[model samples]
Target: VMRANYRKILVPITEEAKKLKIFKGEPLDLNEVSNLNTIVEIRKLIKNNQAKIEYLVENKAKKKQAAIYLLTKTKVEYQEILKGLRKTAKKQQALLDNIVKKYHEYPKFGSKIVSELDVSSSVLRTAVKKGWLVKKEQEIYRDPLKDFESRKQKNQIKLNSEQTHALNSIGKSIQKKEAKTFLLEGITGSGKTEVYLHAISIALEQKRNALMLVPEISLTPQMVKQVKERFGDNVAVLHSGLSEGEKYDEWRRIRRGEAQVVVGARSAIFAPLKNIGLIVIDEEHESSYKQNDTPRYHARDVALLRSKFHKCPVVLGSATPSLASRARAQKGRYELLLLTKRANQKSLPKVDLIDLKTVEFTGAQFDLSIPLVDAIKEKIAKKEQVILLLNRRGFASFMLCRNCGFVLKCPNCDISLTLHKDTQQMQCHYCGHKEPIPRKCPKCQSEKIRFLGTGTQKVQEELEKLLPEAKILRMDVDTTRRKGSYKKILDGFGDHKADILLGTQMIAKGLDFPNVTLVGVINADTALSLPDFNSAEKTFDLLTQVSGRAGRAEKTGRVMIQTYNP
Candidate 1:
């Protein structure tokens, strides 16, 4: 499997590279800096007739010529560090308790009680202690407050019948401490969160930990809130949006066992949860689960691997599973559990296509075609809300020179640069290359450079112009960059504060607006227009998902998807 190969390769590299201790290679020449006490142990552990190392590592170590050297600071036992901290935490907690009691008894005498527990000389010593923990500006504790939390947590929740069955089936097939992949094909409005919580409850019952992976930045908050509401402070959340120090703290929490359930975006899969029992990947089919950067790990795949390592289970929940995952389910590799009908048992949305080819417009170059505009007007007049989706974010897809038909393109990318009308600049969505839009086209000397194609900004602006009385809102990346933007927009949407929400793919997936009678896709062509093997799949999935968002409420919604080739 892809995971097995990575574990056999990356683990050795991670361990070896971090220690700078070369295995099956020559020792680092520490002769020049002669304070070296290098002890090279090259005893080849080969059992039976097989000539290989014991670690199941793919790179076989040479027997006679292997030069394995140990560095002075190579390995540190986790138990030793914990033992020391446990002692310190005991002392500190005792001191804090005594001080707290004294303050309660004599509120004014708190200063006097504090002086009694002071380590007067500690203020002078350890000014030069050079250690990883010290370098991180962390206090060396007997038992840190965070650590105490994990150790002292006692509340264990009981599972329901459905949850118990899920656990037992998954528990058996999952093989703990190894990779067990299970797809929980639950409905959007189903209690999949509760199922995940119950599985995690089982993990905690076994004294193992759990990691929940979310596929998007926007999804993290809601998931985190749900997990926190259930597990209290036993959760640590991580995402690309967090700062380095925030990530460091969350990592430490996992390592220290202070965090039992880690809710994060993708990378939470690699969380060093000592003995992981369950891994829950929400929105498993999401492309966000795949890492575009090097070490190209898929969080969902990694979670499956980690589950195998612990011989546990992995739950991949999505309304619409990817074809590959569905195929696996069909092959019996994954136990297919379906929560097909909506919890409320309402009908799914009625999807219709508005062929843009039949519509003719005179001065209209933006996203909304005549039929779509008519549909939006019809929905608004009926007192029902609408949602318009345009995948690309900026104000315009690209700037074009009317004189020579020259399209503005990014210097670093293989794509056209987007025109950010708000910023008066052209920005490369790929490399983030940005420059002010020239008054005259560089190549053609044409001042009449036109912003072409459609985007979220252009759609929102045109909608506002067309429907003057309608309260239209936009929720793409640019508008939601600030903290709490997703929540704020979601709240606004829930309250029906906006008549319509015009956005990119962010508004897709599992958002339900009961009053939203109409869901419109300005360009169905954008999704299918991709030049990839998964084009048809992407088109179908996106089209289906966006349609799913409409009729989630009792109103029995309608969706109008406009396509150029319709």
Candidate 2:
């Protein structure tokens, strides 16, 4: 049986029976049921709905067990019991004395008390029998962020004139409970996040909740940290990176109104938050906000709908707003708010373009130019960090037989299979088809093969050879496959354990490293040749956003773009 219901049962029929022209609802002998490829449902199989159904219940966030002790004996009676047991039962006497001294702190977790007093359950039962104490069970909440230490903001950040103006506009909408949308067009390091936080504070002051949506899972850690530092335990995080237990506990907390702020990825739009006063979508132009699968929906559209229901303000913030959003702002459909300067009063990074056609290659591969390599070396000598962007992830974009003019491609997909040197396999990124690296061409027994395109892995190898003394950390889909791997890599980089960080577009935006003083784009023209009509727009947005990553802190920064087209 494939499935069953209270009144019916579903069974799969073999293909042979269908070939034999067996019609639906046609009664078949039990012997004939073994050979068919069809679906059959038997009705009225369970009389009075007496069929037994079983399911597993996932209650990871159930009520916890606690212990509370109260002294039933009076002070004088306790003293008499202790005095009488001092000589006969020294252990009981000591236990009784300790319980008496800490009776006021009765309501504590059972585990806490056990670890603190170093006593067993049998001893506690004996004490209860002697009337020295009373024990009872209580329920407590399971804290998902128990290990996360709340680092409250030591000194409040003073907002600039533009930030104050933007906050004031959002504040007015929140105060009047108006369902309005705002397009916050701010350059990188323009303090848009500060405005969002201040608006959230105002919402909380009005006794309302706030919901924040970030485009990528990579951005969630930093955003959650900032929000947690501001609101402490009042914030709950929801994202696919979290475990099932953590998600369940956080969901329950939000439902119980224990958390006032919700921060997560795209799916966070459906978070069970009530009385929302504001919704903020950071990097609003990112395509990651659109669900590609069935039940397709965009978080931005959903946020607008939710604003209508809650009568709240929705803020769409981005350094480079999408053309659609910009058009809307131009049409006066969305209230436009602009921030013209960096929050730290620093100048933007200086960017230089290098023509790959004329520039000298730094290594055997033509991925990194000499100028970019020299800049990286300079930064390393000064104890500063660098960021390199490569839009691809494998060791090589494709494997080709130079002699036969043939390329290895996935059978399932027509696209070329990328060569991964670490895995010694050619893998198709689209369909996940993998095969061993080839020595001789299958079509012609020629061994003249070459890897033609640059990716993050190949660049990493080249960087290591070029700068053997420098520490490098690579971030890509291949390296960050395990849970919590994102946090580990980011934390390592933030702690200055690596001299250079390299990755694909995932590292292009929403990353802040104060020590990074140089940024390089291996191939700035990768996205310009795409088949989509919006390819140019996407390429421009990416370059602008990534260039902003440098020179964010007090130190000046430099950027280098290498392209053959230019």
Candidate 3:
């Protein structure tokens, strides 16, 4: 009779929403909401018929569990079996004794002793066959917390008024289980990350995990260090840069509920985490969040769905947010949090633009203007570090012949070949095709060939020639292609081992160098002239972010932008 009545009733949900599998193969429970239209339509249909309706609300909570090995019986209970085995198994007594010793160490789980047994000796197989040993899978607690041996407890920071207000609002949502989205728009060095860490602490206090998405793998080392310093082994890092084995292990950690905090790039949004209390998208405006392939998913949108499902808060933080996010924030869709003041109370850096059309060239190289070179020299004389930004890599952009106006080009690509000075080869950045650096133009066969255009490699060479005593660490795709090279270069620069840090746009953001008082932009118009509308916006962001790296300490920083467009 109950089954017949259940078939007469109807409930429906959206296809995508139903994919969550919250309601399946049963009458809709009162705890779950059904569509109002469906309920109203069903009532009208049943009005003329003899039918009764009953509603019941029952709260059901289930504990999540994972498979773990446990002993079939206690070590004390196994003594009788060992006594029987000692008589029947004469040669297997040694292996049996070792297994007995291992059980004494970890009596709750027998799989812990599986590795200690040499199954090739046939003792463990014999014992299992004789009912002396049993392998049983049971529910076990998964503990993700691990002790970091050398980490020093960081001193607690006093939040400024602005940070305090943002924290209070964000924490309120968590405490009330209200799913909300916040756009944390702050200027460079305005303590956005500090707000994120503190909010994550609150989520942990609520006994929930947090998921943080960063844009690049290069940014992971610094972020992992910070989170580990705070939460230790409760954190798991995911990114393409990790080995397959490492990725699997980290995924298992999250799936088994061993990791309460997940920090990763785009793919991390889908981490197998349950009851996530918070989701953070650092640098939310970055284009990296948009997946270009099939099953296309944006990290921000995924965060929203996850937040809605778990009744948590999502924080989108960036100094320069994307237009779509900023527009949403302008509306009532997302709550906006602003951090206008610098955390350290330091003044913003001074910016100076040198018009390359009018400025004097330095040492016959058009790449470095005289004023910019003077500023670098001045900073080095004061023993302060410097960072030079040139978005291009390789030694020279192209090789050109003076006589016939012939240019070297890649065989497989329409783009010109780039000269790598260190490798003495012309490489195609697009297709990885490489050839010997030609002494003369291939088309004209003229010896009067010149390497034209500027790259980070060329800039580094010019700096070496001009500033002979300056220790320059060049970081780009070429220098940092090897694993751990990025961290090594940054660490060397942070330790004051290098006087100048030169790199491409990868060095533009997420780097804080206090001793760097001078930031020189060799070519500000590189991205500005691209055939894209957002070229101007990207150029502005790169300039602003790179300039923020300097003068972060007690020093006053200066920026000299050498540009043809002024």
Candidate 4:
């Protein structure tokens, strides 16, 4: 005997069952029954009445359909169709006119037309029925890299002896289907990327796929642009910066074996592209490769695992190799390839350290020193560009009251709330908590409030005041919160629209601007002050990578590091 509905039992005439609204000879949904004891008692009565039990089925999520409807204009005469339609049917007429005007010669997206014109599906169906329009349902990928223009012709870059040797060594592994790992330790401006591109081409030539992972989303644009220019539509990019639809579409493309080359940030290591002939992890030393959240996986380790599964070679390229990767090479577990000279045969930028404790500052904030300001002026006068790395965002690090020594902090994380002048809000970086900037100190109600510490926004304000004519572009998490903002900022800087590109750590690496002749590190001690064990290593990596952004072209580059500790 099995449990039965309380109402389904004929002999359920007890006081408790009546209190629960259970009636005899009435089918009751067990879900609506509240009291467990009453339900059990009613089930016992039903079991004595020869009732049987049935188990409920759990619902499963349905698979998402990737196909979408596509609309195109047919050869039917639009004027005749409009003439046949009643003049009162203005919506249908307008949609027909738009389809003829915009999509007469080519296929147009049906959803785009519907949203843009606010036309309903009924109108489209009527038009399709009239034979004035054609509808075809097909799976289409939402291209995230659509903004990047493809190169009409792929220019063959002449690789130097070092680059050629590295490519050849990687090529041998690809040819032999050996799951080998190689440590490509090259200087910042050495043609490591070029070597990666050539090796990707070799893998494609073998009718196999390839994956390239960058450390940051900021770097993805430049790398994607280069790869797209080389491989065109065959390239797919995956990163958090893309919208969910874009990521899903790109993922679908990779899974369907449409994209031959997949480039993205750390999470892209899981792209389902079978027959991977090569895997390249750029900036291998970057700590960003390790995911801090659940299912914490490092991309470098995943790349090695994928290489083993596909029997392909893995390339770990970095200017400053992590100690673990370097040690592995030393232990003969991974082959080490060195590229000492710059790819363009140019000299490394001359790095000068400014003693912030001794040198006079250009502004009251003491963020930019006299030498740095003067060098910036010189570069602006020469019509060159400058990249200023502050490594922090917002206007101020924290708000402090001089009278009461009170500091505003996030309630959730207990971290100082950063003052963002643009939004006029105090925001916590770790937990995303935001509050309006207080007029006075919350603790003491003192009017004597001061914002301390420098950020990219404050330095940008200073730069504008110092170099009035300099066109500045600020790139941080605040400015780049919108979609396609990274490409916009980088493209604007690349086109020489901005003389100074001010940003945080995101701007520190994987950027190549030939016109950028000078790079200024507003404060070099920020990273070194961290209590972490690898803070010093992170500091060195930041300095080395950011310094590489300057003088990449014919002009010699210069870097000034302002550090009070130095």
TM-score of each: 0.69, 0.85, 0.74, 0.82
lDDT, candidate 4, 63-122, per-residue tens: 233323345435356656767888899889888677567654346667776787898878
Q: Every model's Cα RMSD, please?
A: 13.1, 6.9, 13.2, 7.0
Count of clashes, each model: 20, 7, 0, 0
Q: Quote model 2's TM-score.
A: 0.85
Per residue, candidate 1 scores C-alpha lDDT tens digits across 367-459 of 567777787788889888888888889887888889999888888886899988888888999899999987899997979888777788877
Task: Identify the runs in model 2 with alpha carbons over 4 angstroms from their true place.
Answer: 1-98, 117-148
Question: Between the candidate structures 1 and 3, which one is better when assessed by TM-score?
Answer: 3
For model 2, the run of ten residues with the poorest summed lDDT: 1-10
Instruction: Choose the strongest candidate by lDDT.
Output: 4
Give the TM-score comparing model 4 with the true structure, all chains together: 0.82
- Looking at candidate 3, the ten consecutive residues that score lowest on lDDT are 1-10
Each model's C-alpha lDDT? Answer: 0.67, 0.84, 0.80, 0.87
Q: If ranked by lDDT, best first, what sequence of candidates would result?
A: 4, 2, 3, 1
- Candidate 3: clashing pairs of residues: none
Per-residue C-alpha lDDT of model 2 across residues 1-566, encoded as one tens digit per residue? 11222222222254433334443544333333454343232222223242222333334444556786666866677677777775766557666677568656654555665667677766678877876667888756555445456675455999999999999999999999999999999999899999999999999999999999998887777778788889988999888887665776787788999999999999889999999999999999998999999879999999999999999999999999999999999999999999999999999899999999998997799899899999999999999999999888999998788888999999998999999999999999998999999989878979898888979999999999999999999999999888777877888999999999999888888899999899999999999997989988888888898899898999998999989887
Candidate 2 lDDT score relative to the true structure: 0.84
